[model samples]
Target: MSEKQAKKERTRKRLTQEEKAKIKQVEETHRLEARALRENWLNLDNAALIYPAIGSTEWNSVFRLSAIISEKVNCDLLEQALRDTLKRYPFFNVSLCDGLFWHYFQTLSTAPKVELETNYPCRPFTFNRKNQIFRVLYLDNKISFETFHSLTDGGGAMRFFNTLLARYFELTGVKYKNLGDFDLNVRDLPVEEESEDAFHRFANNGKCKPRKETTAYAIKGALENPNILNVVLGSVNIDALKECAKTYGATVNEFLSAVYLSVMIAEKHHSNTKNRHPVKLSVPVSLRRFYPTKTMRNFSQYLNYEVPTDRENASFSELIEIIKAQSKNINIDYFQQMFNANIRSERNFFVRILPLAVKDPILKFVYNRVGERLFTSTLSNLGICKLPAELDDKILNYHFILGATKLNRINLTAVTFKDKCCLTFSTRLSERRVIREFFKMLTSFNLNVEIISNV
Candidate 1:
């Protein structure tokens, strides 16, 4: 009787095991197929490819803050907080994988490689160490949050920073009630889609004539400690600035670009170079305008605006007109061509698998040379931030630091926060008089402006 009962029970358990195994196998098959499709689509768009040559592209963003707080914020706490936060919000927790022929592939076990070297050209892309590519560095007076650009733009970063800081204060026992109100629940945030429409389009109609002559300027100064002066200039009402742009038939971006070009031209003239070649400034346009996708990967593209160097007598009004004309000419077809061309260039299998050992050196050489000759400076304008209007109460100010690109010389980043636009200029040049003069001129126009210098 005992033997018969035991055999019956064993058979029942065996059937249950078989059913579970079948279900598990089906789920695995679905996941593998989904991953393959993602890889293939990324390959077609050329969005999944990584530039092995660039050091900054590999490492996550790094921040160095002044050490003032008495309590120490350790990595363990940061890691635990991040894990809990990610569990609540899965989108920020995802990473990319390399597949053969851009099809379904196996997940790699190791963390996506993040190259961190002091000499690397670009600013560190933030990596999520706990979740593949996202990472946060907390130094005694400095905190840097770096992420894969595909996850979020500056606006997204700002939101993350605010939340992280609130969490830090709560952990440190700071008497901040707002910290409790902060929603660390990732479930509340909307998941971003990876779509073609997420990028800004350009005109691509203008002629690309060869420059008459190219000049190189070697940046001089300490790469680390360039005198960093942060000036809090007077605020400009967002509405007034918009109206000003309308009056000039230019968007807020075009107007800011013109202001930057004017400053650069003034500096070039001060150098007294006889060659009157046009000065080119690279303007990084947020792709969010053209496409609706907001996932934080390198979704931004750039356009170049050439300002006549010989315009010593050109009034600010005239310069605005030139910028308006150039900016208006940018449209969707122009960007599609660029998007298509970049995809073709990376189609070579060798380019995708090139060993970093060989690629990095070649990239360094090419980047250094191009940095000296191609563009005078980079002008990045992160348009007016549209945050939940309620944040206007406690949020004091917002600012952005320019990334350390291939060129260690100089770069300008402008972000409009609240009602004011903050323009930050980073350079290795010893003479910051040009930047000062630029601010002074703005003041002369009765645009309440302030200057902060690292010099």
Candidate 2:
């Protein structure tokens, strides 16, 4: 090789080693506490006791970053700044291991071995060659910021994006005024207090076995020309939606729930069932509301509401009233029961000691069979997103994605953008047609709706 080529190769090797050393330093500084480990185990294993089951195929979180820099952007400087920022926040650098039995922290040398992509349609939990649980992908300006959901949830990945963007600006000769204030305290959040009354009520109520499947009608349709569609979200003035709810004595959630369920019932013709079984709607209630905790790991609960099929034939006004009544009954007491039941199951020493590999398959089977029988679909309303008023003049829009649980056959994710609310419905490939038809009916009601898809 030429003298210049040999010198370039030597420089490259030195940089690689330096990067590895940096990663190791960060990992060594943030050792996991015993309480944190126990909490992590409970979240990974016990939470599967309720809701939909999670397995190796659906257990991991994914992160991806794509940048659209100005034409004058220096790629090398931008990359260096990102590396420095990641070295400061190493939690994003680790992954789970031993079939979710432990978290195998990654060193700089080990990080490069993790896979940047996966073949699964839904993000599955898996360990990388480095024995880490998460992976990151870096792309150029070819992809849009909107494409991030193909990997991880909004909550898990957004902070990393903000950090990357801030660093990029610094690399391009721009001074970041608030860089010192960007520190995040993931560990300082308060622990949730358990309610004894709630636990007692739950124990007395007995365990709820999966309900038998009802005879509700299922809707079907086909997209004439399916493609990944752009979503142009417009705010619905929260006051307007709230006023609509107040007129019918309903809360904002109940009002939206009624509208969504009405669309489903109209499309499915659920009223025709011989036994008049109710159409169920699954709502994900954030545990943060009932419990005062902010652990970044999985911390959410769900409640199911079965809307009477007869409401499909009622006037819209009447349906909204019924939904309001149902929602008002949901309170701290209800969540307490859920928490107590979950803890009761996890407290079983024998079950707690069972290896995750053995427990996972059995849990998966029961969850898929039992969960589907209880609910028709899921609704996750993340409410208003908390972002800075100004993000380099690019306003952050709404966030939504499909749930990855094994029994989560369909999910409707809603978030407020500016003043309007944007809702996205995600279903199995088999049920995509049903979702499309529901959106079509929503548009026909004069509701400004848009469709976004990965097709």
Candidate 3:
């Protein structure tokens, strides 16, 4: 053999040793925790307790978050990356299971399948042993992750998604130069607190406050196909949105919420419905800011904001202040009350002793009757996502999509990356008035809004 071939052989062996050394580093740190987690069964996190009871196979509680990369996805490399990445996020390597009284997550000793992206995003997932609660999908230049709400919320899922992207880039022989907001070294291990139930940890046993009772008006529209979730996506300049919000002395989320409420109010008037019920917006607030913990589970509380029925005719500026006032009432003390109420109900002796068969129906009934009744629409702003400079060149943009619900058919979500903010509307309804007016309103403010894509 030539001397050049011998040199190449030695370099390949050295690279293999380096990879093994990195694997050993992670195993040394995570061996004990990973072993225990796989052997144990854990109760659903506080915010997730109702999902199993409420979800169905046809429309299970799931949300999709997709990132559009500049390059096409390589299936073989993605599959290999998933295997290595799961080692860092072993908690996500679990499946849904049932207990005598409640549904739980049981760690799996096996790997999950990665699939091609479906035409419809946020496709239903099963809550049984047959399938994992989350899936990784790729199509063309896009990579989408659909997860069971019971598994994690947007924040947690975003971190996992970002890590997976970073790993995928690494596997493609990209230089490990900048990791900006991600801490995804190949040897990083899961921290213990990342798996804890934060709501229980932060619960204060105060008096449980009774939630306000008011039925919000609903949107009626022509339904799409059962297998389809209609998605409308728009991109706006982050600076332009920020400036527009500043004119009203509001944050970007507050301004968007007000716009959403304003549109619904207009829709109500246009429909000529005399119900005159309060049109409320359910705005989800991430609890990570108020707390010190960083658990990769559902840890958010939503604030229900509405224009008072008496003030229904109030102008757009007034709605902005109204949302701001409602937002101000949200802080540690407010979340504590929510935790108290939720835990108080969960800890009741009757609730605890009930069988799963008996409790499931009741939970679903409460959700449909009380929970869905309170909000006309839902909006979750996952704030801006930032990746390393290198990744910025490879990843074009990010978007968040909330799956449609029965009552809240037209829901909104926005995610920003760098200078672009993508606003996505997910609904089963074919009617486009509210969605059309939403963009029209943003453009009315002299903001440049463009349609990104639709599904």
Candidate 4:
């Protein structure tokens, strides 16, 4: 046959038995993968539903969790650790997709990648990316894990990071015993409890009247470069901070909240204003503490604390007392009320049936207009992180930071490990006044704080 005719004959050749078998095998693999993906998919929970509805490039709800180790990060080992870690958390490696009526998560077949840390924490997440919801980054001695808020709260993120770190150490030939839930020997399976939608499990239909919230006096300053967030991380002695809290008859969170309120009040003092408007602050209370749920999703509520500055000369002591009292009222009933208010709204006959394409705009409007204006700033303390005694010495410290929102320029987050407490102030505005006063107040209380700022 001529060369052209031979080529045409080859192209028209039918498949052999081996070729047919290979094709069938490939098709079978794909079918299995598709089935697994479908089985792993989950609808967004009650608390998580709002995040995708309102998240934007400028105001995404994302946060960062970091672990500082004694030695520099081993990227190769870390990557392997990530792959192994992700196998156990099928839910973590998910890509979010929009449905006609809601947003849901689909488990990804691709593995999570670890890269050298270069950018700031809490970059926007586009579902189209290879890894949708979270990124693992390493720089020198620090390994940082940043995730979309809808994926998990700080508590959940911390557990994931701790496990990742422990697994990384294991890969690096570090002998550590009792690796907790991160032991690779554990079977790679999703815990039913960990992936549950706890809010739905605990929510009640009991209607709590929505309380009126006044627009807070916003902290004004020259806006920083559009997307850049200024971070000021202060490492304080945990014992000293606890001692200071004890002196004031408050917990560390309560004391810190008081300190933040005082700093806001001090801003007015520095500006020489006698205006007595209340300084409002919001503190996120984890629902896991109230309800017994192992879900690693967003299961937290906020306690909005307002110190009535209308009282002439509201002292720090007075603010602490007011904060303490408000905190006492944040029991199970309070969270149930908060959950009911949210779930009830979502359960509205019209809301549940509305198409997402149409519902997103309305939700965004409500979040921006009503919710965003309620609190001037937020403080989320993940509290003390515990690890096995064997692994504790190799790890140095931990830090948590809440990304800023459009109306709320500044937000604070704290997590303690070992003897050190890492308190991070993340701000979008180009003003250092709030953080500066915050650290100064801690120092004035005789708690020495080593301050570092990301310019």
For TM-score, the strongest prediction is: 4
lDDT of 1 by residue, 274-385 (tens): 6556777788666656765544445656677776555545887898877777777787555656655554445457755765455446655765565336667777766665
lDDT of 3 by residue, 294-314 (tens): 798999988889887787788
The ten-residue window of minimal lDDT in model 4 covers 179-188
Error of 1 at 169 (Å): 9.6
Q: How many residue pairs clash in each candidate?
A: 39, 8, 0, 0
lDDT of 1 at 246: 76
- Cα deviation in Å at residue 37, candidate 2? 13
Q: Order the candidates by TM-score, highest first.
A: 4, 3, 2, 1
Q: Which 10 residues in a row give candidate 2 its minimum summed lDDT?
A: 142-151
Please provide TM-scores, in order, for all candidate models, with all chains considered together: 0.64, 0.65, 0.90, 0.92
Alpha-carbon RMSD to native, per candidate: 8.6, 8.5, 7.8, 2.9
Candidate 3 at 91: error in angstroms?
1.0
lDDT of 3 at 222: 84
What lDDT does the true structure give each of the candidates? 0.52, 0.49, 0.87, 0.83
- Global fold similarity of model 3 (TM-score): 0.90
Please write out the lDDT profile of model 4 over residues 326-431, one tens digit for every residue. 8888788878887888888888999989999999999999888888688878998898898877777789888887877768889999999989999999988887
lDDT of 4: 0.83
lDDT of 2 by residue, 249-326 (tens): 777787777776776676466334444446677787765556543333334556776677656577777777776677
By lDDT, the best candidate is: 3
Give candidate 4's total backbone clashes: 0
